[model samples]
Target: MTWRPAGVMGVAPSLVVALADHLQKLGAVERVRDPADRRRQILTLTEHGRELLGVCAELARSADAEFAADLTEAESAVLTALLDRLTGR
Candidate 1:
């Protein structure tokens, strides 16, 4: 898989160390040194991060349902199929 920067939301390469330290203090994530490359580290989400993801998923589902409520079932299905085709999924 290709790796892409998280963009502005990411602590860029220059600020990764400081960002890791901040996340550690907040107990939101952890940085682990890769066994194959001691100089490189990967960030993994902590329990708090998983909980936040669940909350966000619920919110996203609610918003999607609301947005599609006005459409007929067939229309909604067609729209979803079109989106899937566009996304190649």
Candidate 2:
């Protein structure tokens, strides 16, 4: 994430670190030393984070459906494609 944040997530590495630290403090994520390389740490989402993401996914789907209600099916497909491209997915 620190290396690919700009392209993959559209955020700065420093910003990701800050946000990850906060989430860790909030029990949404945990950081542990890498078994193979003690100098590095791996970040993994906790149960809380998974639950939060599930809720977020639901809300995002609802909002996207509402936002696309007026567009034709082709237009909706194009919009989704464009968004996926922009997000480097």
Q: Judged by lDDT, which candidate is best? A: 2
TM, every model: 0.65, 0.75
Clash counts for all predictions:
0, 0
* TM-score winner: 2
lDDT (0-100) at residue 88 of candidate 1? 71
Question: Which ten-residue region of model 2 has the weakest summed lDDT?
Answer: 1-10
Off by over 4 Å in 1: 1-26
Report the error of model 1 at residue 18, Å: 11
Which residues of candidate 2, in runs, are more than 4 Å off? 1-7
Could you give me the TM-score of model 2 versus the true structure? 0.75
lDDT of model number 1: 0.79
Candidate 1 to truth, TM = 0.65
Worst 10 residues of 1 by lDDT: 2-11
The lDDT for every candidate, in the order shown, is 0.79, 0.86
